[model samples]
Target: MIDQLLDRPITDFIPQREPMVMIDKIITCEGNTITTSFLVKSDNQFLSGNRFSESGMLENIAQTAAAKVGYECLKNNEPVPLGFIGSINKVGVVDYALVEQVITTEVIIQREVLNVTIIKGTCMLGDKDLATCEMKIILDLG
Candidate 1:
């Protein structure tokens, strides 16, 4: 069952085709809570000095949230809408994602208010959390 879930890549969900998709794999997903991983490379245009900044970490979380939205929509045969970060809250950078490290991120959808979905997520390099944020993502029709 889990194998079938991760079978399709994140590209099938979100519209990011190239040089933009940040997530590499879905480690585990259960509706509102999803865990994913990304391989950060020096070649990635978004990375600086083989490291992803705190803002980038937030972006990564937002993209991961979109992935969850896409998965649900596809499973229900509905359209996945384009989404944006509505607001940021309690964001902290404990460290930075280094080169050649596959950063794993986990996001939990806490609530939906005023058409915005609230998400709390964390980025980790191994067991150490590199960053964490509570964000609100706004959905817009594509």
Candidate 2:
């Protein structure tokens, strides 16, 4: 089931549309961990000069988490729920990705209660860490 979902267009699993969409593909979704990949384009909204900004990396992490929820909802034949970033904590930015670079982000679910989920996300460029943060997402199922 998981293999069939891999490499598909990122829009299928994430509610974000073009321009605002930060992730390009879902690399893996298993258990409490989800990974995604995004190519930093020259015209990306979050780009400043040739570098992808910290805010963009943060959005990528959140979108990766959303993909996990969207993937599970798809598997259960449910509609994709809208989600918002409630808060962010412990943010650390070591570097920024340049244009044409591919960013790999990994999100680990920390907890889920009702419509709220807590996760830790780390963004990487190859083996180099770019940024990491713990985010709380609130889902709207209504």
Candidate 3:
């Protein structure tokens, strides 16, 4: 419901667990572009559990893209369509972001063929960009 969008961020919506929740809030979403934010806390399970390393910043960018799609479908419409991540490729992490830093990630849809959505994303902490990647996400309802 639209109610969920205001009270809590997308990361807390649905059932994505602690470490897997990769987004904070939707910054800008219109047409085929969406921006979101995330803060990596020292208490994050990934940082604390050793499952995620500093070099995994690209993955965070990809996940932020996922969060954007979910938010777009959830808050902008009635039925709340569901989408899934198909692939993420050509990733590079710039090595500036560290653990417990807030990042602003943006996703722009570059290609959309059929139901597949291909997007380019960048993760930035304030004005500093730390990672970039192109992700192919499979969004289908079936």
Candidate 4:
């Protein structure tokens, strides 16, 4: 089942639609960590002068985390909950990804309490780090 889910479109595991979907595919979701890949397209909204913006990197991270939750929910035959970014901390932008470059993001679940989940996300371009941050996501259970 997990292997089948990996072959499905990223949209099935995330709430964002076209143009707003930051991730292209889910590489893996194991234990408390999830990894995703995104290609920096020329027409991407988060592009800034042929480079992916910091905001884009951040969104990619958040979406990676969302994919994790969504995948789990689907596997368990449960509805995927809507979630929002509660806060972001310790953000570091090492460099921006150029257009056509593939950005890989990895998000690890740091903690989860009730409806709130804390995750640490890191974006990488091959061997170089692009951006990283810790984010708090609040799920709407009601």
Please tell me which predicted candidate would have the highest TM-score against the true structure: 4
The regions of model 4 sitting more than 4 angstroms off are none
Per-residue CA lDDT of candidate 3, range 40-134, in tens?
77666546353334444655666666666666656656443456668778777665555667778888899888878899988777888777878
Candidate 2 residue pairs that clash:
none
Error of 4 at 24 (Å): 0.6
Give candidate 1 regions above 4 Å deviation. none
Q: Which runs of model 3 end up more than 4 angstroms from their true locations?
A: 1-8, 11-15, 48-56
Please count the clashing residue pairs in each candidate, in the order shown. 0, 0, 1, 0
lDDT against the true structure, each candidate: 0.85, 0.93, 0.66, 0.93
Error of 4 at 137 (Å): 0.2
* Per-prediction TM-score to the true structure, in the order listed: 0.91, 0.96, 0.75, 0.97
Candidate 4, residue 79: how far the Cα is off, in Å: 0.9
Which candidate order results from sorting by TM-score in descending order?
Answer: 4, 2, 1, 3
- Candidate 3 at 43: error in angstroms? 2.7
Q: Give the TM-score of candidate 3.
A: 0.75
Clashing residue pairs in candidate 4, if any?
A: none
Model 1, span 15-40: residue lDDT tens: 77678888887888796798899988
| C-alpha lDDT of residue 127 in model 3 | 86
Give the range where candidate 3 is weakest over 10 consecutive residues by summed lDDT.
46-55
Task: Between candidates 3 and 4, name the one with more favorable lDDT.
Answer: 4
Global lDDT for candidate 3? 0.66
